[model samples]
Target: MKQAADPAKERYALMEKIQMVDFALVELTLYLDTHPQDTQAIQQFNQLAVESRDLKSAYEQRFGPLRQYGASFSGYPWNWGDSPWPWQL
Candidate 1:
C-alpha cells in the first residue's frame, strides 16, 4: 500500500518553491531595471511571476493565506489560524 503524504512537509516544500521563484523574480526585476533591452530576461521574469502566483494560490487553497492585511483571501471562519505560521514551518 502507498503511504499518505505529510501535510506539514508538503506545505513546507511548496512554500520553499514559492520563495525560490519569488526571489528569482525580484532579482530579475532588479536586473531589468538596468538592462531594459534584454528581451530574454523580461520573458523569464514574466514566466516566473505567473509560476509564483500559481504556487501561492495552490498553497493557500491547501493551507491558508500566505499574507495578511488584504493581501490574500481567507476562507470561512478565518483559516489564517488553521495552519502553521511561516516561522513555525
Candidate 2:
C-alpha cells in the first residue's frame, strides 16, 4: 500500500537540496575565479545551476516563495509575511 505524502518533510528535503546546491555553486565560483580555465568546475557550476532552479521551483510550488516578493498567487491571500522563517526550521 502507498503511504501518504508529508508536505513538511518534502519541503524540508527540497530546501536541503537547494541549500546544498547553492553552497556547491558558491564554492565552485570561488575556485573558478582563481582557476578560470578549469573546465570541470565550470561544468559542475552549470549542472548545479539547473539543479538549483528545479529544486526552487518545486519548493515554491509546494510550499511558498523563499523571498517575500517571489511570485505570489500560487498559494492564496499572500502569506509570505507569515512566520516560520527558513532558519527557524
Candidate 3:
C-alpha cells in the first residue's frame, strides 16, 4: 500500500531545494561575470531560473505568500497573523 505524503516534510524539502538552487545561481552568476562567454554556466543558470520559478509557484500554492504582501489574503480573519513565522519552518 502507498503511504500518504507528509505536507510538512514536502514543504521543508521544497524550501531547501529552492534555497540551494538559488545559491547555485548566485555563485554561477558571479563566475559568469568574470567569464561572460561561458556557455555552460549560462545554460545552467537559465535552467536554475526556470526551476526556481516553478518551485516558488508550487510553494505559494501550498503555503501562503513567500512574501507577506505577495498574494491576496488567505484563510478566515487573517490567518497570516496566527501562522508560524516563515523562518520557523
Candidate 4:
C-alpha cells in the first residue's frame, strides 16, 4: 500500500463503530451476568466482544498506539514544536 493512502476517513469510521460495539458489550455484559439463562444474548455478546478486540488491534496496528505504552517508541523532535491536534483531520 502506498503511504499516500489517506487513512483519516477510514480511521474515523472505525473509531465510531468500535465505540458503539463497546457500549453494547458493556450493557449486555451487565445484563447477562445477572441473567445467565439468556443463552442467545450471551452468545451475541461473546461474538461482539471478539469483534471489538479485533477491531481495536487492527486500528492500533494501522495507526499508532491508542495510548502511550512505556518507551516502546523512539522519541523525535518533529513538531509541536507547533503541530496539529489529531482531530484536525
Candidate 5:
C-alpha cells in the first residue's frame, strides 16, 4: 500500500509553488508596465494570477488562513491561533 503524504511537506511544497508563481507575476507586472502593448505578457500575468488564487485557496482550505485582518476566512473557534504558524515552517 502507498504511504500517506506528510502534511508539512505538502504544505511547504504548495507554499513554494505559490511563492514562485507570485514572484513571476510581479516581474511580469513590472515588465508590462514598461511594455504595455505586450499581449503575451498580459496573458501570462492573467494566467498566473488565477493559478495563485487557486493555490492560496487550496492552502487555506487544508492548512488555515494565510492572512488575517479580514484578508482570509476562518472557521469556527477562530483557528488562527493554531500551532505551526507560517514562520514556524
Candidate 6:
C-alpha cells in the first residue's frame, strides 16, 4: 500500500530536486556560453528547462508558490512559509 507522505519530508525532497535543477541550468548555461556550437549542450539545456518547470509545478501544487511572479501562485503570505524550519529536521 502507498503510504501517506509527511509534509516536511515532501517539502525537503522537493527542495533537493529544485537544487539539482538549479545546478543543471547553471552548468548548461556556462557550457553553452563557452561552447555555443555544442549541440549536445543545447539539447541538455532544453531538457533541463523542461525538468525544472515540472519540478516547480509540482512544488507549487503541493505547497504555496515559491516564485515571486508565477502564473497561478500568489506570493508567500506567511512569514514562515518557505521551507523546513531550522528545527524541523
Q: What's each prediction's clash count?
A: 0, 0, 0, 0, 0, 0
| Residues 1-89, model 6: lDDT tens digits | 99998987888888788888989899889889999999988988999899988987887677766565335465456423565432342
- TM-scores of the models, in the order given: 0.91, 0.83, 0.77, 0.66, 0.91, 0.77
lDDT of 2 by residue, 1-89 (tens): 99999978887787888899999999999999999999988999999999988887777777776655544434676667655666665
Q: For residue 81, give model 2's deviation from the true position in Å.
A: 1.7
Superposition TM-score, candidate 4 onto the true structure:
0.66
* lDDT winner: 5
Candidate 3 lDDT over 1-89, as tens digits, reads: 99999988998898888889989999999999999999999999999999988887787678765656745445555556645555676
lDDT of 5 by residue, 10-82 (tens): 9999988988999999999999999999999999999999999999899999999887899889988799988
Candidates 1 and 4, the one with greater lDDT:
1
Native-vs-model 1 lDDT? 0.89
Q: Residue 87 error for model 3, in Å?
A: 3.3
- Residue range 1-89, candidate 4, lDDT tens digits: 66675677788877777788989999998998899899899899989989988887776566544433442232254322222232342
- How far in Å is the alpha carbon of 67 misplaced in model 4? 4.9
Using lDDT as the yardstick, the better of models 3 and 6 is: 3
> Ten-residue segment with the worst summed lDDT in candidate 2?
66-75
Report the Cα lDDT for residue 53, model 2: 83
Model 1 regions more than 4 Å off = none
lDDT of 4 at 50: 95
Looking at candidate 1, the ten consecutive residues that score lowest on lDDT are 80-89
Residue 34 of model 1 has an lDDT of 100
What TM-score would you give candidate 3 relative to the actual structure? 0.77
Clashing residue pairs in candidate 2 are none
Error of 5 at 61 (Å): 0.4
Give per-model CA RMSD: 1.3, 2.1, 2.7, 5.3, 1.3, 3.8
User: RMSD (Cα, Å) of candidate 6?
Assistant: 3.8
Relative to the unseen true structure, what is the C-alpha lDDT of residue 21 in candidate 1, on a scale of 0 to 100? 99
